[model samples]
Target: MNYKQIVQYGVLIFGAIILIGLVLKGNISHEKFDSEKWKNWTETESELSLRWDMMNSLRNNHELIGKTRTEIIELLGKPDSETKMDFRYYLGMSKHGINTGSLTIKFNENRIVTDFSVWQG
Candidate 1:
């Protein structure tokens, strides 16, 4: 190819790489746990707001409760840890020196989520 054509192709390839990186970043950033939200959240805040966020999180992830292992992985990616009968995800958010909390999800032998708990640390 001519020098100019080669330059054009290089720019296009670079742009594609950058775009793919951004898309992957976006997916990772929108995890089942949102630490920044928790960091800013104070126990003293309105109960309504806290409940809202909690409910939203559950709503978004409730589908995993009954999904097969393969299905959950397709949607939420691989868990931090896994076993024959359970899966665990340790995740959370932090910002401005304040951390919201880490959330841990538990799944049952059926490969469906059974419960979740949170810890502020």
Candidate 2:
């Protein structure tokens, strides 16, 4: 057509392209932000390390179980004696309160606890 008509069409086409680009960018960023937030949430859940220091609490009092020999020594200060059986090692629990129980740990080799049982007296 004429130069003016051609120029007007060109401007209209350029504006339409810019509008489409902005809409596409906004949609892409919205999706990306949502995915990033979801990734952060999942990673945060998996990064938790919860340790139960039951033996530490037990040592301060009179009875604790499932602790390594070092932990027992640190907590109870000392032990009266140590005994070994065919299946496991025994850490005796003395009476500190109403609950009196013994901690038994079954070992496979050396002194590793493979299984455990608690006997309350």
Best by TM-score: 1
lDDT per model vs. reference:
0.54, 0.40
Off by over 4 Å in 2: 29-121
Q: Model 1: runs farther than 4 Å from truth?
A: 1-58
Q: Which 10 consecutive positions of candidate 2 have the poorest summed lDDT?
A: 43-52
TM-score, per-candidate, Cα-based: 0.39, 0.26
How many clashing pairs per prediction, in order?
A: 3, 0
Ten-residue region with minimum lDDT total, candidate 1: 26-35
lDDT per residue for candidate 1 within 15-94, as digits (tens), equals: 99999998766233332444344334444534223423453464565654566777656544565677676555443433
